[model samples]
Target: MIISHKNILVSGKHQKSIVTDVFYTNEIVQKPVVIFCHGYKGFKDWGAWDLVANAFAKAGFFFVKFNFSYNGGTVEQPIDFSDLDAFGHNNYIKELDDVESVLDWITTTHTEYTDFIDTTKITLIGHSRGGGIVLIKAAEDARVQKLITWASVSDYKNRFPKGADFEKWENSGVYYVKNGRTKQEMPHYFQFYTSFIENKERLTISRAAKKIKIPHLIIHGSEDPTVSIEEAQKLHAWNRNSHMLIVKEADHVFGTKHPWSQQYLPNALQKIITESVSFAIF
Candidate 1:
């Protein structure tokens, strides 16, 4: 049977705790670890991600998913937009640091996982914004053995506002992006924009993709509305060694929606999970 643990807190940036969940079998053999990073306005427990974690666990991987320290989710409640203030203060750099903290907890003194996981064989999977962060991290961190991105954004600069909107955000110090599902106004502080500018070179997905020597997989939908399919092609163009898979007629989330009560993984998600498991193990 597979063992799963949730709400496990690890220390991360800004003196905040990173809430996480780990899924793995209690088998004696060492299993490769898969660390998943969620996208913007996302938490660890959103949608059918628990099922995604289970799918990875069943596929012989010690799957892990965590909220960024500033992801607005607390240890008591690791879902939804609970703390918008923490969410607003968040930046890509902090997200990178948070992922590293999870890595550190898994590979080192975290005794609960050390015996069952092969920390050296860590693979990272990110969706949308998180995917871009993974590319940047995998390029710099030697511990990451493989990488996969689902409908990932190609660049950080393009996501931010431009012209007057940009000027207003800079002057006001924050901008609110309405959450379609929650109907809450989510804040993206100007520091978010400033962070991108400060670390422009390091945060560039194309630059990082070209530098990645290990295996990489790009999974995206042909009709993704949130992020175009061209982003995937651009990533592939930079990293010629990487493989790209486009799901026909798939949208951004591949039909997986929040509040998903289904017992099984969606067809699109299942395909990528199977493919990701294969890619990570190979």
Candidate 2:
């Protein structure tokens, strides 16, 4: 398999947006394509994603995993939290738009892979929060033939605290949450909540998952603390055609972390990647 990293200027929320993509392909002539979207605080090179991309490419698919425009990375520096302002200002609607932009660019603008890509067969894969984004995108975009989520959330509203304080948040200009690891205060402007509330009907994960007439797969870890296995069950329940698989003892990242090393993947993560490829093909 040949794996290469490149950058593309995608139409973003602002004037000019840059996205870094990890492209994977074997020497095969033309192959089905899978485009991956990372979750919050996730970039294209996060942990073992590159390895996963390679695995998919080796299995005879053209895989591309990209960093969201507002994912805190830049064209100059495609890794880490160098652009917190873009990260803080990001919202679900913008992400959905970004993914659409990427798809449009690949299918219409990118010429080198035009003959090598089977545009008719396109799949969108997302992890964690990104899973919700893909679900919504798939429901709305008929171009997406298959949808898959890794440790996906069934509902975006559940991420926030409920009740009358919702109005309190509306009045406040911004809300802050602590990153347990980085210890940096993450500021979610009131506009985030407002945008979500305004677009709730369009952004509902369950609604999107349920409406998906195409094949869907939900993969999660039984011991995942970040997103419970039940979330996977909920996604399956919402989409009767969807298949759910739970790894017995994998964590949120499937046993991978930042600055990860060692070539071999954890047993559970390998299973997740393998099963995802099988589902995509089947």
Candidate 3:
């Protein structure tokens, strides 16, 4: 039977709490650990991620997924954007530190789950913006044994605004982007760009990808409009040893969407999950 520990708070970045969830089976048997990081504007319970976590648990792996403390979600509310202020203040350094805190929590603080976790075989999986986070984490931390990225961005600096728009953001201090699903105006403080600049070398996804010596799998949807397939190609090019897969018609979310209500995963997402499982196992 799969056991799930939901809505647990893990201390992270500046004492803020990271809302975390863990899924696993067989309490007595040690299983490979998989830590998943959600993307920009994403939470631990977004869409079919719970299903994905259960899939990993059923496969005899200790799976963990968490909100990045500043992803706009609070400890009381782990889904959707609740605190736009925190979200606006978020930066790459905070996210990287959050991942480290989760790793520390699982390996040291959470002794109760130690029996079911294999710390030495930890794998980091990230989706979209998360893919970039995991890549940098995996490169810097020796604790991670394997790495996987789903629909990841190859560059971060390029994602930032340039020229006049950049000047406008600098002058205004914060810029807003309307969340299509939530229809909420999301704010990005100019400090976000400054933070990235402060850690530019460390936050470079391509640099981290090249530095990774562990097995890495890169998966992307060919039709993903949010992040193009060429980004995956760039990742593959940077890491000659890494494996890449282009899902024929899958989109950024792998055919899954917010508030996914179906009992089963979308075909494309299922295929990605199967591939990820195989990659994690072998």
**Measured by TM-score, how close is model 1 to the native structure?**
0.98
- Positional deviation of residue 169's Cα in model 1 after best superposition, in angstroms: 0.9
Q: In model 3, where do residues sit more than 4 Å from their true spots?
A: none
Q: Order the candidates by lDDT, highest first — what do you get?
A: 3, 1, 2
User: Poorest 10 consecutive residues of model 2 by lDDT?
Assistant: 13-22
- Which residue pairs in candidate 3 collide? none
Task: Name every residue pair that clashes in candidate 2.
Answer: none
**Candidate 1 wrongly placed segments (more than 4 Å):** none
How many collisions per candidate? 0, 0, 0
lDDT by residue (143-200, candidate 3, tens digit) is 9999999999999999998899999999999999999999999999999999999889
Compute each candidate's TM-score over C-alphas.
Answer: 0.98, 0.93, 0.98
Each model's lDDT: 0.90, 0.82, 0.93
Worst 10 residues of 1 by lDDT: 107-116
Cand. 2 Cα-lDDT: 0.82
TM-score of 2: 0.93
